[model samples]
Target: MRQLILLCSLPLLVGCATTKTGLAPEDVSAASAKGDDVIWTDAASVEAQCNAALEAGRAVRDTIVRESASDQDVIRGFDNLSLAIDETYGWTQLMFSVHPDKVIREAAQGCEKSLSKFLNDVSLDRALYEAAGGVDGEQLEGLAKRVHEHQMRDFRRSGVSKNEETRARLAELHAEMVELGQSFQKNVLADVRSVKITDAGRLNGLPQDFIDAHAPDDDGTITLTTNYPDFFPIQTYAQDSALRKDLYEQFMQRAYPANGEVLLSLLKKRHEYATLLGYPSWAAYVTEDKMIGSAEATDAFIGQIASIARPRMEADLKLLLKRKQQDDPKADAIQVWDRFYYVGKVREADFGFDSRTVRPYFPYEQVRTGILDLYGELFGLRFVQDKDADVWHESVEAFDVYTGEQHVARFFLDMHPREGKYQHAAMFPIQTGLEDGRMPIAALVCNFPDPSKGDGKALMEHKQVVTYFHEFGHLIHHLLATRGDYVKLAGINVEWDFVEAPSQILEEWAWDTDVLQRFAKHVDTGEPIPAEMVKKMRDAEEFGLGANVMRQVFYTAYSFYLHHRDPTSLVLDDYTDEIFRDFSPYPRFDGSYVYANFGHLIGYSAIYYTYQWSLAISKDLFTRFQSAGLLDPVVAKHYRESILEPGGTRDAADLVRTFLERESNLDAYKKWLTE
Candidate 1:
């Protein structure tokens, strides 16, 4: 709930914006939205449709297997069936709107049921598995092996190995887990919609747009939500310590609604689900498909970093505390809210750098081109802007990315903030490739401030630039993936720990002055970024690096612990406190339910540690570029061919080794923590 959706007014394109749903402003204006159940009768009717779709798909697969059809025919069959399933899942995702529609629920449940039945059908499974894995090494080729492995792993994970009764229970558990996850998300969203701020003076040092957006009608005071743009900046810069404390408590207290009972129940249910699957804990059950594969390794990695970070973070906290005493006489020990504020101040003081001044050189359009230029030099890819695109939002701009004469992939840049949309920057894969002519389309979504205001220059902060590059890295990964004939195996479908490495690696380019000067130009003035300022930014990069790395390690370690620990012996609150207690700069409060606010743990389950694990790989990968030139095409092509193009076809560990000429080690990450 600390990251509530940030609503910003996006600049308009030439025409009216329309989403794939065709539910534009005009459509909504004329019709009252239908209820969940209004679209479909009950779960039974939805179930019938799902069954029919599955039956049709199965018949197609049977034909392919029986006839020993070529890969082309198999691809065509998959395309048609995948289209239908995609349509079904699209509606399934839309069910969690403000108004509940039972049709969405019914359809989702029905589809899950159908999928379960399909996976458990032994004859068909053996046929598909054999076909995908291949006989005499003549079956699925290239990325197909990756897709086959992913499918096989999923089948095993879903209790396909269990008896009939256990299989049935597995489906039930899946349905219940889905329901619980949805409920948990909705409850947190609902509980922390907006916090009331009665005093207007508390808004001192905040941006004007933030105040304008959050100010209540007929009141002088401004309110705030959990959105990163509003929350993080305020938490870091707000002068009023009381307001900061209030916001911090409100954010932290989001998880333990009803005194942690809800989260505890959910955790227990998760434990039951894992135990039912013949696993020791939820962590073990989920990790088999992930790169880390075990809690012991993940915890050990965290511990190694912690040993280095503990002293550094403590020293940094002491410095901040000493500063706080001079800045505000009444200040106690530095709290959660004060962390960002002091860090921001220390950064400016240490490096003589100001984010606002650096912003002038990084206009939104310039930053976009800068990212494209860096990749272009490295990968020999050209991004030509596509004027005629069926874009979902007006702020979205499309580009057709090409490698030499080959049309490799397309990209959409939705790089502005808007209401009712996801707040943080993320990459959404529109169309993933298989063996067929199905190419990939990826969108880079961000919440950067609109450029059309008084400034007319949409300058971006340094941190914002890093986020922009990070999300685009995901876009490149999705678009460049030449995976086999399965939708699930394409692009970001690699092991969760490995997926972030590609994105994290790109962040290093943002820090490099050579790359920044190429595209970082003043919007109105059109002047290049000064060398001295660039030097300062680089010098400041290592500031608070220890605390930052520790924060990531803490979150990652805590997530793995939550999944692996015994629920009976360690309650949800206790488990959270125990894992994260030593890592945080501030003291933990009783009944802290930070897990409730963590959407990653919900979406990724035990795989949240993958970020840190991937960071290790990314660090190792970045070091190669540091040794070689950052934009060296020879190295870039190696990355493209070995990592990006293969997608999840081969094992992620193999991909890392092939690219680096050795196994990925944690030494770079450990060294980074000490810095």
Candidate 2:
């Protein structure tokens, strides 16, 4: 997942030449340039820093709205406002997810709420709207023109033209929604559920390293948390049905009782916010600016994909049921807990491949280095570790990206699990790059196996390697795409529905035999993975495609419908179960509350369908690679220039058309699903 913290759209309200804070102009410029003053250890400093930025941003806003302001002045002012946001609210938002100190995280969350309210108030400012609207579009060219146009559009969509009373109510609703979103996310981060196993024998099918990592305590019990490092192995390899079921349910119910009302409140507030703007529902308002264009179009797309996936999903279920019958002849249906185990069984028995056989070749450190080398070779870039750089954690690694001698960007990898850290994998942008010499900074926050523990060999599942590639895709996209002058058009600031395409397309490299052999050497023998084994691995990979696509469809529908209609009489738990039964191949578990822990509901809102929509675009994009050869530098360079370097300066459809020399369609995506 690519986690986007709002930075560019919010305008400042007050117009003043002097800032209230005592900090000098040079101090503010240096702080934004270095990108190192992000971490906040004390709660008070978070508030102080945010207040200072707000003062500076107000001054910029004031200058933009002045009578003597020119087109160039307006553009610079908006860029300066973006700088203020990156220095303050943007950094704090990242800290809220990755910071080690709980007190600091909570403080950052509070600052974020304050910033959100400020943004809401300013977004409704009539003067700011009029000033932005007054920009001469004919005077601006290229990205400058696009930036001016987008700013005006955002102002209108933010209810800048509404009456004072209505705008005031919208501001209150915006603040409440932000508060509820933070509460919902915080509950999931704090609630790390675990199950203890009294009998060690039940851990039979799990890998030796996993068992070694969780050695029993003096009380003779092994405890497992719902973290990815613990949860996924149990789901795929654990032999005990009862144990898997217990862990599965516990994992699904992560932030249950706490987030239940929080989600409901969020949905209700969002619906009201949309209706106030004259939209029927939140989904309708949110999708209007996206590539999908409208809620009805989004619904039709979901239906089309679901229909295409249903046949494959049913066939995959039959395979799983047949595998399950060998163990329990009376078994009539596969349980949710049974899906992973049986899929692995079918792959090993029918496809002549076992996932465990590939783990020894994917120790965490080797895979990390291999990925960097592979991408560097393909893209004509270099990565050097920055040992002197400050990091939030000792385990975090920082690096500088360069194209030949010119430094292009910086990134960090925090790729292990800890208490209170974000549980899933995501790319968090820390700083937006600008042509004015500020380099983009990003961080990949993931929960992969730690090489420091368990005999010093953190052998990753192949799927984890794929996830690493997917996330690094996002990191590079952020770095490579932000060479433009405007922060609003920088990084992955493309349309919401198209943001995942670059990342999803990169997942293809993870499965390539030529690519894997470069890094996937055995932990003990140091020999490259066998080509025949890679072939079998690829074959097994296709086995569960139908079921997987349907699962995504189910999530997309759930996210959409939750905001697509009135929530005044909706019940979160009941609605979740109902959606599951309607779209999912597997029956919903009796007591499961999956929605409570679904963090995407908070960040992604009604646009979870973006994943699949972008996947279709990605598949179409990959055809050029398929013909030109995956590692062809000419093709890669063309792709970088045509598809990525423009960032959000051009419409996403135009970028795709430029790269492929034609409009993108679903032909490639349909082939991928049915073949």
Candidate 3:
């Protein structure tokens, strides 16, 4: 998701927009387009073109209002204003992370501030909000009405009806929050840490290739960082308790003290802004715009599941305790670092499977083909890489998405770790689709394994393979899906809670035996992962799953409590320790800044609960796939039309109901948890 709900400019009403919802295809390119052909050779050229478009948008907006443009014309003007800022700024933000040039990155940071201020002004404009007077919403239909209603709703949430002084203050707060959020992410990237493994004995359980990748220090020690590929392998395999503890502490302590104050400050401003917007708290403020409708409702939803899941979580913990006690008679308690360690042991003891067992058959190239081929087979689409296409980095690849003969979108793939790339997996929207011919562009930024590990061939763990499928689910959603009004109803624009359904449903394919056998093959032998092995692996995958789901419950509760309560009472560490300990099956570790590593605390805020909330819906969706057959084109087509294609044009519940032909329930989710 772009997450520019606040940064994006909403439609400013005029008679023009209501009367002329759109232009003829021929008229759009000649009479109305701006900033569509942005050249990226230099920052100066980009800035000048963007500024010109901004000026043009302003002039056209003035004319539309002055001339009392029709409804259709007003919508067009709003779209133009949005595209000018979005097409220019969106690409600039994408380049900031992936572009190799530091100068361009710096320029992007500066431009982001400028764009933030501009967006704040638009959101706070009294004249624009007044022009967009409240409507019964019966006059328009489809995306046009969605855009109209959302525009008015956005203005209200942005405090457009508030007095000028208060509105101005809110605008300032919005700008500050953007800078704080950027700084929060930058701190994480800037604060990388590592520890050296001084003894070979400490690396006893790790794979040879993993050990070989690191250049031994002069003292013959292997240095490892907090990056996922390195960090996860260590936790999954390392036999030495001391070494695991060292790595865990270093990883958990990232972005603290540096981001501690930043997080605190961000929450403060958010509370103030939300307060000014007439909400009692930021949770309420954010929830008003989401499908859940209220903070209390979201809490009740989480509580309902937590009540059923607690005992299941406790049962899973007994297995962890049994394994820990077997390792040492004196080991009565599981520490934070011991969860993965003990879980790995218990998994091997019970299921005869581990990540290392299947890594051989799940090499990088095959995984990519398997995902693309599966999507192509089911969705009637093709993904073609333009090796020569201009991109921000050497590793970044450009590809076009097509449904049969029609090209729908372009996406860039930057799927490996680097010195300063974004550390998580997400689909960044570069440009949004429009009915006016501006095609959508998106980028999938992930820190999946690269050549640094071994042989320059990335072999994903089964979990990583699922992650790949999950993130690409978001990408295909952005590409295959189209909305009439692109701004309000484009890719990943559904309710925050519902956005994960498409991706989570796709993840189930990774666990399916038929799907795995279709493309998962050994790098050396070209043999598909054995059905027997995959079956065991699939069952083993659920080992301790209840505890894992409970962990999400903890994260959601911690975040919700922090935002929904008084900000003055927040002591970042104490609040985390208290709430996190409630759901954690083990004791809290010392000096652990787990909150700092949680990017959602900054971006997701109250919506962290959405992952679990969406998972319930995701599970329900996969039941349809399971019954219909994994590769059934008819079911896939129905999902595309009913779930993925509608975008934000309809409410998420409505979309799900239309797809399932009945109201959704948590029965599938409960079955998943109990199974």
| Residue-level lDDT tens digits of model 2 in 1-675 | 111111111111011000111112333667567666466679998888888777777777788789898878776676666666654665676788889999889988887766655555566668777777788888888878887777777776788788989888987898799799999989999999999988889899998999999999999999999988898999999989899999999998888888898998899999999999999999999898888899999999999889888898899999899889988899999888998898888888888987779999999999999999988987888999999878888899999999999988889999999889987787877677766677888888888999888888899998889888888887888788876777767777778778778888888888888899999999999999999998898888788778878888898899999999899999886788789878988888877887889888987789888878888898899999999998999989988988877777788999999999998888888888888
Better of 1 and 3 by TM-score: 3
lDDT of 3 by residue, 1-675 (tens): 111011111111111011111122222344223323333667786576556545655665564465466776565555555655655556666666656667666676666556655665666667666656633357867677777787787778878798879978987897799899889989887887899867766788888889788758788878889988888888878888778889899998899878888888999999999988788999898888777899899879878778767887889888788788877788877776777888888889899886677988787777877888898888888899888786667777788877778777788888888876656677766666755456777788877777546796687787778778888887787665566755546655677667777877788888888899888888888888899998888777778787777777887787787889779878887887787666665667788887787777776787777777778888898888889898888999999988888777789999999989999888888888886
Query: CA lDDT of 22 in candidate 3?
Result: 19
Model 3 backbone overlap count: 22
Query: Each prediction's Cα RMSD?
Result: 8.4, 5.3, 5.4
Q: Alpha carbon lDDT of residue 71, candidate 2?
A: 79
What TM-score goes with each of the models?
A: 0.80, 0.85, 0.86
Task: Report clashes for each candidate as comma-separated counts.
Answer: 7, 0, 22
Q: Give the distance in Å from residue 657's predicted Cα in candidate 1 to where it truly belongs.
A: 0.7
Worst 10 residues of 3 by lDDT: 7-16
For lDDT, the strongest prediction is 2
lDDT of each: 0.64, 0.81, 0.73
Model 2, residue 451: distance off in Å is: 5.0
Task: State the lDDT at 502 in candidate 3.
Answer: 84
Candidate 2 global lDDT: 0.81
Ranking by TM-score: 3, 2, 1
